[model samples]
Target: MMVPDRVEIDAAGDAVLAADQAAALLGVALPAFLADLRAGVVFSIVERGEGADAGTLRLTLRRRGTERRLVVDAATGRVIAAEGG
Candidate 1:
C-alpha cells in the first residue's frame, strides 16, 4: 500500500491543496472557496477507509446548511466520491 503525501492545512483549518482541487472540480474559483471558508463554511480533510477510496483525502464541505463530502486523490486531485449537496 502506497501512502499519500501529507496535505498541509492552513491556520484556518482548511486543507489548502485539497480545497483548491475541490473548488476546481466544482467549477469554482479558489477565491470562492476561501470566501466560503471565511463565511463559516465547514471544511475538513479526513482519511478514507477501505475499498477503492482508501488512503485518499476525504474533503467534507458544509455550507448554506447543506453538507457534502468529496473523496479526492491526494496525488492526482481526482474527485473519486461526492455525496450530499
Candidate 2:
C-alpha cells in the first residue's frame, strides 16, 4: 500500500491583506515614500500579531524624522488604529 503522494491541509476561509495594500489604505503618497526610500531617508516595517491580536497586521513607516503606524485587520483589510499618519 502507498500513501497519497501529497496531502492538503485546510485552513478556514480568511482574507489576508498584503503589506502594500495595507500601506495604501493610509492614503499617503507612495511616490514620496519610494523617493525617500531610494535616498535612504525612509523605512518601513510590517509585522503580524499573534494570540489575542491574531489576524492583524501592524505597519510602521518612517520618513524624514516622522513615523506613522497603523494596525489593520488581516481578514477585512480595515484600519483598526492609526497614529501620526
Candidate 3:
C-alpha cells in the first residue's frame, strides 16, 4: 500500500481549500481517521462542493466495513460535520 504525503487538487478560485490542505487539516482534527490511514485500512474520497454547498468540502474515509464522512469549511479549514470517524 502507498500513501501520499499530500493530495493536491486544483480548484478554481480561492474559496475552497486545496486537496492536500484539506487532507492535512482532517488528519489533525480526527486522530482516529489518521490512524486508519496510517494502518492502510482507509480509502479517501474528496468532493468539492457546488451550488449551495460551495466553499465547502466533503471528505469521506472508508475503513474496514465502515465509512466516515465529514463536511469541512474550506476557507476556515474547520470541520462543519463529522459522521462515524
- The numbered model that scores best in lDDT is 3
Runs with alpha carbons beyond 4 Å of true place in candidate 3: 1-40
* lDDT measured at residue 38 in model 1 versus the true structure, 0 to 100: 82
* Candidate 3, 1-85: lDDT as tens digits: 1122323334542234343443444444356656666888767777879999998777676656766566767666566776663
Which pairs, if any, clash in model 2?
none
RMSD of 3: 8.1
Root-mean-square deviation per candidate: 7.4, 13.2, 8.1
Question: Candidate 3: lDDT of 60?
Answer: 74
Residue-level lDDT of model 1, residues 1-85, one tens digit each, is 1112344545544345556655654445779877987887645546544686565667665555555566656565555667764
Worst 10 residues of 1 by lDDT: 1-10
Residue 12 miss distance in model 3 (angstroms): 9.8
In candidate 3 the C-alpha lDDT for residue 21 amounts to 43
Clash pairs (backbone) in predicted model 1:
none
Best by TM-score: 2
lDDT of each: 0.56, 0.56, 0.58
Number of clashing pairs per prediction, in order: 0, 0, 0
True lDDT of residue 61, candidate 2 = 65
C-alpha lDDT (0 to 100) for residue 1 of candidate 3: 17
